[model samples]
Target: MTTPGLAGFIASGEDSQTCDVVVAEVLEALGQGFELLPERGAPRGGRRRTWFDTFDWRLYRAGLTLEYAAAHRGGELRLTGASPYGDAVQLVTGWKASRPHQLRDLPDGPIATSVSGVVAPRALLPEVTVTGTTAAYRLLNEDGKTVARLLVEYPAVAAGDVRPLPPRLTITEVRGYLTQARRAARIIAGIPGVWPVTQPLLADALHAIGRYPGDYSNKVAANITGRMPAAEAAATILLRLLDIVEANVPGVLRDIDIEFLHDLRVSVRRSRSALKLFGDALTAPLAAPGTALTGRKLARFAAEFKWVGDLTTPTRDLDVHLLDFEDTVRTLRAAKPDDLEPFRAYLKQRRVREFRLLARGLRSPRFVTLTRDWRERLTAIRDSANAGTAATVRSGQSRRAVVETTGTLAADRTRLAFAKVAKRGAAITPASPHDSLHDLRKRCKELRYALEFFAPLYPADSYGAVLADLKRLQDCLGEFQDTEVQIGEIRALATSMLAADEAPAVTLLAMGEVTAWLAARQQGAREDFERRFAEFAGVDGQRRMAELLRGGAA
Candidate 1:
């Protein structure tokens, strides 16, 4: 069956004058099953509009209610299911039918209308029921296909001085009037695009409610608060989804190419990580019937596709190449004019290649798909862990297991950072001093993170010394690295122009100046490193880090 959904925009005036008009229109069209949510003080400035305002209407004939709420803050109008506990199964309307009513021309007069029986649900959609003089209209599309039968009613009319209309024509006349009123309102107050105010997960829950026609309170709650005993069930489902996606990646990549394949891989890894992080929260609500299958399936998939370690290798390699290229440019620029021309062509070609590689690495369609897949997987993992049903003892054990697992991940992250730094540092050619220094700075950052992860586990004295030395190295290297990066860019640009046979003299001149500048910076970095290397590479530094991690002391 098609999903039941609604989409609309709303506008509110500062004085709340337009609010009454909007409400009257809604009441006249959808009936008095709607009520205004209590105003919660002045809205914070520049907040997005939410579906938490104005009138709610219920049509008992269809066992459904449409709750309309508007936020003037961001000019958002939300139309969602009115039932507080269940899914929005009974409401069936296409996108076109779900569009919001536009407010139109306003009379310079006071408007009063009473709407009741629109109470908030403790959870999920609100509870509402249509009441009093109601009328039903066969809503038709431009093609004259019956879209939906809208039942609207007004509360008992008190002594009013307005023109009276026949019962049969009440709703039809009101619909026409509302259509015009909404149009005028729009002219007076322009409508804005739907604002992104809610969390993605919450939005997903709302979507699910609109999509599935079942009791979805638990699902909604799980999504909104990320809390639910049955979260494991959802997470398990998510895991399955990931597996399905991952399984298809190779084939999809074959059709779409390598870029998307790479993205798919990354997505799989991220999804796995996210699930691992929130697994506990997800498994709390699931029963035994499918719980084991869920856990084992996820664990198995993760183990089978465990390639995060492998993927990091390429990332590290690319980083090293980038550093090498930077150093080459710097070195060439600093070289004497006699030595610059030949290297100029080489440097230009290399820079272009590097840029292309970097672009491909980042922008591949596969990568984008993988990223999305990963997000979904993570969500699922969290859901599963939250939903899983285990004995109290088992649950506690799982939590402890998760905590312990974090330590290993921390260690791996640290190791990767150190290794990358060492690799890049070693790859710095004489020609690419600037790129080398940039790599060095990156390495230093990784080292710092590593130290941070191990800090709590290290002895205070040792930790302090290591941190101080690392910091000193970073400070010295940082300055050298910045100059290197700048010089490299300058050298690269010069080389490119000379290679193209354009402005050879000017490019050559600029190249020389940048090269000399880079040489001085490189000399400074090397000298600084030589002086500090003893302290940084000493037993108390490198060896000590190893010893501490191994539960030993320097």
Candidate 2:
């Protein structure tokens, strides 16, 4: 998708230097009926505008932008917005640092609507900042009434840098004046080095400074091929994941965003899943000596990673409650909503305390030892493997081949996971215990993570169908589990809050209502499970899985 704004413009032959010439020609073309007003010193000058997004650059990826120009500009502001992906529109909003930067800072309006739709509760960390000078002009009709406006933007080398960069022109079409706006566009289109560009000025400035979006994602994906050694692939995957864990630790400690810890936990879980899916293959002899871990050693590392996953669960689970508390309260009695505030306070208190403990665990000497050992282990993997008969069978290749590559083994591992999930799913009957569903959820999750780790090895089209089916099944199971957990947490929270005198009967009633609502949702999920599972295990899904497992044109 082409970016919709200035980048979307067809460059006219004249550059910014000659833009004035185009304006002169345009004024001439308009004859004596139009007036070209003198330049006004725009109130927008001298302010350093900074843009922000989540760590993953989520807003930019979703074709949205959020910026907080500083209070340094000092007043109400007018914005001309454009994107290569959408419409160019105008907005008026305020910028002040009354609190930490958040989407809520904007008054209720289109700009706020655009931002909240994207960033939501996520923190708006500074992505980039640029200082620019603004020059404004008014386009007047023959009656001396302004029908359109123009602003020329000159970005500096950096915030407050004296050297001025090339300028960009912004034309604001006054509402109900399409004809005059089109005429202005025609004149501007005729200039060189000056045309509409959709890329945001902040983005353009960042690009000029060699920065970029999507610099981080909550998930880490690696490219693995069928020709690679299993041990080699394991090293490649683990090392990348290890970096993710380390990178997220700081953010997790800062508690800037819940996803930092969520993603950190996911990486740890994916590590454990790799070990289970690969089993003995992780310890298979590489073509070189000391290049692979023994199964016993691999098992120990998986256990440690599991420990890491365990430490983050409670806090994250509670974070989920607080994050959803507003929505959850909406379904309860109006007065009961404020009654839940104390519960929220309790959750936040627990979260902060638990997060500190988590930070301490991560900072401990033992955790350091485990990570150091794991990093050393990555260096031991061989570039290629000489799979014996034992490794051969585990790899799911033709037994006659007598050898297997890590890439081939990766597909085999994914197949084993799918088979396990399929077997588990097929075994569940309506009479099965709640624990059975929980077990199925865990197994299905492991399978899903394994597929993600091995996805690059398969044809995306074929793999995607199977993945979608698996995800649907996972979601069904997930809704069941999350609601159950939430219900339990809410009850326990109510009891604790009451014991602490946070509230009395009102809190208890609120908890009861919330719990009942969750139970109803959980019951609905339970009823939906059979049909969702059937569709997932149906003929079409089976065919996709078969194609994925048998190795299509990956």
Candidate 3:
């Protein structure tokens, strides 16, 4: 989606040198009935302006923009709605040592209150920087009343070196003069060698610097097709997952927010699942004396990824507890939320220690090797698949006969995964042990992950129906397991706090009430499991899964 802004015109054929010519033509054209009056004391000299967003473009995606200007009108940090004509909430701090990193860094006022919901925890890193000079003119109608504001920009992007950008003309709407503003825009847009700007100036500047807004995302977006070779498809998914892992490393290291570590762990978990489920695709012959390199690499990388996953767990667990601390306390019938302040302090202290280790592990030589070598290996696998496809084309062999495609592999793996879930689920009785339900939950998760991995191979409607059924079952199982874990963790925390002499008798009593609350939740989830699983393995769900399997096979 394009960023919202005023009706803007960018030079289509003219460079910055000849851009002034277009502006001249615009003025001459408007001379017919409209008059251009320069705003007195409007700066003609350029000032540096920097746009900031989360690495994932959280602000931009939310239809908001935040910028700091060195001297545009006056030095200030401004946050505005998407529309260029929208009123801006500004904090006037003329020439500071540094810009605010997160919304909390801004003073508590309209601007801070506005963005607090959007950009908390996530640091607002600068995405693009540009220097531009603007000449502002008021477009007046027949009675000499200003109907619109026109800005002529001479801009350059600051990347490695100063890169001149195409000059732009923007017509901002004046309040109570919508028709005249539209007429003025039409006149400016019709000028030769200019076209209406499709995106914000930030996009243009980012392009000049070889960066883009909203380029980073945590989700896997690999484009896989049924006809693609299994190894290539697996590699494509792994490579995409790897990108997510890498993209989040900086944020993880900085400890910017809980999500960076959360996303990184999720990618690692998915990569492990893909490797185990698609192991056959990676079974290449021996490379060195008596050693199969592909298998060896797979095993080694999987172990390393597991280690990396383990490293982040401690900190992530503590993060979760702290994040949910307020809500968890609210569930207590007798204890006020503040009664658990000691417990909150203990969680924070543990998190700081755990996070130090996490950061160290991420920066270690072992992790460096894992990311670097894993990328190279995945690339080689993808290239090998491409080469095999080329050979099959040349020799006139059927694509399926020469290499395993996603169609065959997805069907085979998904069938096995589904059968595993069905078999385990069928064995569960109302009187079954919690361990039995936990084991079945594991199988359900595996099946869900397999469906997610190969979703591109099936029709969206069929896939969605099947996944919805599986997700209902999975959610029930997840809730049951999570509550049980939370109960255990709370007990452990109580013990540790007592041993450390940190927990008073009152704090322990509060924790006991919280534990009772969690036990009730776990029992509720356990009771609901039977119904959720019945729906998951019900006739309609089974039919959808069969259709999905057939679609993949076909």
Candidate 4:
């Protein structure tokens, strides 16, 4: 019943006392049905191993693991499944670098291509590194075909001070040899002082270094409850948002990748959205002297976050521009992409300047004060709710605890947001001004954020259905807005370039052509908006939204 490719830890005492006897017992347990054969040139000792994953553990979440190992001869990269059953595809890359932070740093090959596909735009950071000596043996059946493989590893943490870890035995099942692999695993488990490993060895190694995989994530994961105080719920979400914002700051400063800044800005924006949607929910009176922590008090922090968003916008916009430049070039009507090289150069230069400003702002005392004060305030609100502090609504009505629960508050907010979206969307006519569509887009975004924030308080199916409809509508709005913004930005950039004497005649013409194409795209989005809105506002979608609202109340 043992899982193939299962790993077990061997007690140090038993391993040291009966190392040879343990191997003999495994061989004997095979009962001559299988023969043990030592693999030729197996690494007995002194191989450096490093485990790679994104900061968010993207590969681990995707059920894959990437490992780089170097020996006296060369290095090899292996991409393996993280399942109990071993599955691996490897490339024998020979010592490309000490460490590659990004996919581009990896040599061109299948491994690199596969990794790039998974961890797009995120840096592949070394999660754990260890020096281990492994002895490999193959289990062969009577037909002389390998049925299973076993690796006995003696690993130590590869840090400043060497710390030895427990020895492990890994039973790797060959394809179509599940029975043989299970037998090997059973024999190993039966051995005295050997215990099955619940987690992977990489997790163990990471623990030695006081780290764990998937420590950072950009998603909002507030565990809000139906009966929980709204203030506490809001604080929980804001605190998590702050954590995301702070975690991404180091990556942003290091310029590790563009995603860091993007994630940070998104966290800040989401924090602001939470503040807006949860405004009524955050009415719990604080234990502080006199004044309550109302929207007025939070207004300052909201402004500070707005500054953070504005500070990061320039760099992020340019990043989007450069990232989409190739596709834009391909869509051009007249000028060659090469003609836009000067404009691209200008964008890069502007990005560097904007990034410098951004870094300075982030490192400034204002940011430090904002984060620290924000955390303290939010924590105080959470503690006040925990203490069950009395609060009053702004209209001077005594607050009822039931009405102030996360579920009730979320339901009220969701209804209001949906109503706003419905009103704005219904008002839009085919001949309505572009500004009208833009205004409705903002309303749709607010509704989308409300649903997402309070999703845990509603039924999954209902929430999902409503969200899917909204997302479809949002996609159309997003495409339309993006093209509109790009058109304006291109025009502005063209003017600036001309002013700076940086734009050649060809580049100006190319910019004009790209702007025209973007306008056409925007027109197409505008034309298709009615259908997407109709689907979002359809009877089925409305029913789901109603059900979601009722579910939250329940």
TM-score-based ranking = 3, 4, 2, 1
Best-performing candidate as measured by TM-score: 3
* lDDT, candidate 2, at 459: 76
Go through the candidates in order and give each one's C-alpha lDDT.
Answer: 0.41, 0.70, 0.81, 0.80
TM-score, per-candidate, Cα-based: 0.32, 0.75, 0.87, 0.86
lDDT of 3 by residue, 467-523 (tens): 888888888888888888888999999999989999988889999998898889889
lDDT tens readout by residue for model 2, 127-201: 666777776777899788877776656676464444344566666767777677666766666654545676656
Per-residue lDDT of model 1, residues 1-554, tens digit only? 11122212232233234534543454343322222221233212222112211121122222443332223322212333334444321221221212232121111111100112232211122221111244344444345443333332222111122221111111121233345333322322232221212322223223423432222111111122111232443353344435544444443323322223334444444445444543443334333333333565456545644543254334333333343444544555334545445444555565456545534543566555554654465564454454342453466655433322333433455555656655665565556545566667756765774454334445677667767877887877876765665566566656666666654564466566656766787678767774464566555566765654554111
For candidate 3, which ten residues in a row score worst on lDDT? 284-293
Better model by TM-score: candidate 1 vs candidate 2: 2
Decoy 4 TM-score against native: 0.86
- TM-score-better candidate, 1 vs 4: 4
Q: What lDDT tens digits, residue by residue, belong to model 4 across residues 327-348? A: 8889876788899999999999
The better candidate by TM-score, 3 or 4, is 3
Q: Arrange candidates by lDDT, descending.
A: 3, 4, 2, 1
Best lDDT among the predictions, by candidate number: 3
Output the better candidate (3/4) by lDDT.
Answer: 3
